[model samples]
Target: MIIVGEEWEELAAALSQADAPQRVYVVGATNSGKTTLCRYLADETATHTRTAYVDCDTGQSRIGPPTTEGMVVHSRPPDPPGRAYLRFVGSTSPGGHFLQTLTGAKRLVEKAAELSAGATIIDSPGLVFGGVGVEFQFQMIDLLRPTQIVALQHGRELERLLANFARHPEVAVRRIPVSPAAVARTVTERRRYREERFTAYFADGLSQEIPLRGLGLQGRVPDLKDPHGVERRLVSFNDPENFALALGIVEEIHPRRRALTVFAPPFDPAAVASVRFGSLYLDLDADPGSMESSRP
Candidate 1:
């Protein structure tokens, strides 16, 4: 049911001949088949050895819910991919949370390396234009130090950005046309997709109260003086090491009691050492809203 163009086939063949432990960073605009290409490459590379698929596209995430970078290690062919590691970025789009996005991607990529994956394929978000987008891509490429970059663009849309890395001897860049099968999605559809993902993630969630006394907070911390400001805000319950254990939706903030009521899937509250707040607010029964921007 997936379409693989000749260019992708050639790229795969070329990669097969290269050295082991390949770090491939894939970039493309929205609906340009970035995920599809990463999936195909992971499957192809897994046949030889363990392959890691790093999902940096937080908006349209594949391994975990939106606003989190996730990684899956494929040990063999036909491996049913699951979230092996997750890092919270706090926003669906990487616009305002550039540092979080870059940091999460780096951590996940490092995790993939730690697993000794033969090939690590990173799928980046489709924010390849504008000042922020260009800078983000540049920072990510410099930080991750990918062995190769597969740029899928319509015409010369990415030429300006790719120009910066053209002479980088350490990284090889490949430009390919967007797949013919790629379909552009409307804003409404993208929002709906995110809503569906959030809804499914919390389908069986139960309300639990978390004490804020010893909990470290990250990202956009809510105003404790105004309890309603944190209502329905998306958040992540992180382990001691700061890795996300599970996501939660703030149902209520008990400022006086120094506790938070969150609706999240079953998770050990004791394991949560910190609470990372996101800019997005979701009611589950209604469309999500962003405190950072109008996105999603």
Candidate 2:
């Protein structure tokens, strides 16, 4: 069962008020129960009108798979999580790509807005600890211009980060309490979660030979022409608009035929408009080596 604290109850009440937030930006430090709070708020909002959630937490993500910023609309209360629209960030963590993260968030928010949901909740990454984390939060707040800023601070650690919004009278800044039942995940658990997600995503296990000449390629290490360059390397297949269609793992890079033998879930070859070589090399059939950084 989910633990709902009194403070969470208060936040939910405020969110349910007639004049409550429409575009709610949920932010918090790592392991501060941000996702839990967002889920609660979404459930509450769904009681009244259509609720849309844009899940931006690539790691430990619920709405979308890892390394993706995704959106889902809750037309009714207690809507089960599903991937509606997604943009790939190429990494589980947003350490190296703040701009990309921000861009993807903005695009997803725009998509959410178009849906005209009564309540739009944005679930952000818990990267609110360092310089990059601070900047990412700042840029997200500035770009989204959300109606309310729901920050889940464990303590004063998030003060400096929330300083900018402190003076914004128009923006309702909510300081909610983190649930006591919130448990911090160990490093081993996180890795296992990623591996499990990857395994489940490619469970159907597709093996297709994709011609390299048609799709645009990104990243450096795995040159499509190089023999065995992209073998076992994770990749994101994109549509023409650059939205991620599916995740893939390279089985073999057929240099002679100018094609990639990749294992991806069922997808149309014509729709595979672009390809990006990621740093993570996950081999469910084999060992996903000790170091699986998302930088190719």
Candidate 3:
């Protein structure tokens, strides 16, 4: 889906003059072979012009670590001149669930607006459930402004996205069907592997790829003591509530006998909290001297 920004009309006029390569944005769920399709397209068109695949799937991103936390061009200089991959790693900030994740996509649009080169292929993030994921797609379209968008379908998600895309005139959305034969082969292989590798007791309610320890069941199964009830608690620790308890057990069994110098540095709690949470964003356009206090 495309949403041309301020200079889109001018850019379209410019593309009409020269041999501007068609920019394509392929969007789909995880493991839907978006990358595979991009690579195939690139290879097919490689002999004539240039091709590049911008991987924007963060968290489980496959493209070698991103150039910048936001968005940056990534391609070796000797390989091709006018072509490069625009890899965008969403946000790394803790609990950054909303617009923060679309930071990379924002940068991508800005860069795409500036380019006058060959085809720019963008592989976007999966529309994972709720509103945040759905809105992120709109943000991407606003950024990349791809002439064409290919959405791979697995369920009703693709239809929903298409309905949203129709509301905007700038984008031309299309649907392509994945081969059922290929999907059937994958399922068969997985079932075969699971039957041979794991025992019946452990394989239930789990994928064949899931490891025994990775289940978080420890050794024995958990009991449903409060199946109907619910409880909530918070601690300084991250995931898995029994982290502190496990650390206490470790200390008792094999304690490290070393004195530590823990000097608490003097810092304003309000300032520290602001910095930690990044509540105040630095204004890049502002005078450097005026913004010095906000920097490290």
- Choose the strongest candidate by lDDT: 1
Summed backbone clashes in each candidate are: 0, 1, 1
Model 2 Cα lDDT, one tens digit per residue, 1-296: 67998877786676667454388898987788888888888888777777788889887878667888888887764556444887877778887767777888998888777777777888989988788778889999899888888888767777787889888877888887677788898877887787787778888977988888867887544654555545677778888867788888788887777888888899887888888766666667655534354422
* TM-score of candidate 3 against the unseen true structure: 0.46
Tens digit per residue, CA lDDT, model 3, 1-296? 22223332333333334365666678776556665665545444444444445556543343322111222232333454343222222122212434534554555544544553355667676564466656667666666677777776666676655676676666667666543322322534533332332122122321111112222322111122421211110001112321111000001111133111111122222221100011112222234323212122
Sorting all predicted structures by lDDT, with the top scorer first, yields 1, 2, 3
lDDT of 1 by residue, 176-216 (tens): 89988987899877877877888788889999998989889
Q: What residue pairs clash in candidate 1, if any at all? A: none
Better of 1 and 3 by lDDT: 1
TM-scores, one per candidate? 0.93, 0.89, 0.46
Worst 10 residues of 2 by lDDT: 287-296
RMSD of model 1, in Å?
A: 2.4
Q: Tell me, what's the RMSD of every candidate?
A: 2.4, 2.6, 18.0
Stretches of candidate 1 off by over 4 Å are 78-83, 287-296
Tell me the lDDT of model 1 at 148: 93
Off by over 4 Å in 3: 1-19, 66-97, 112-115, 181-296
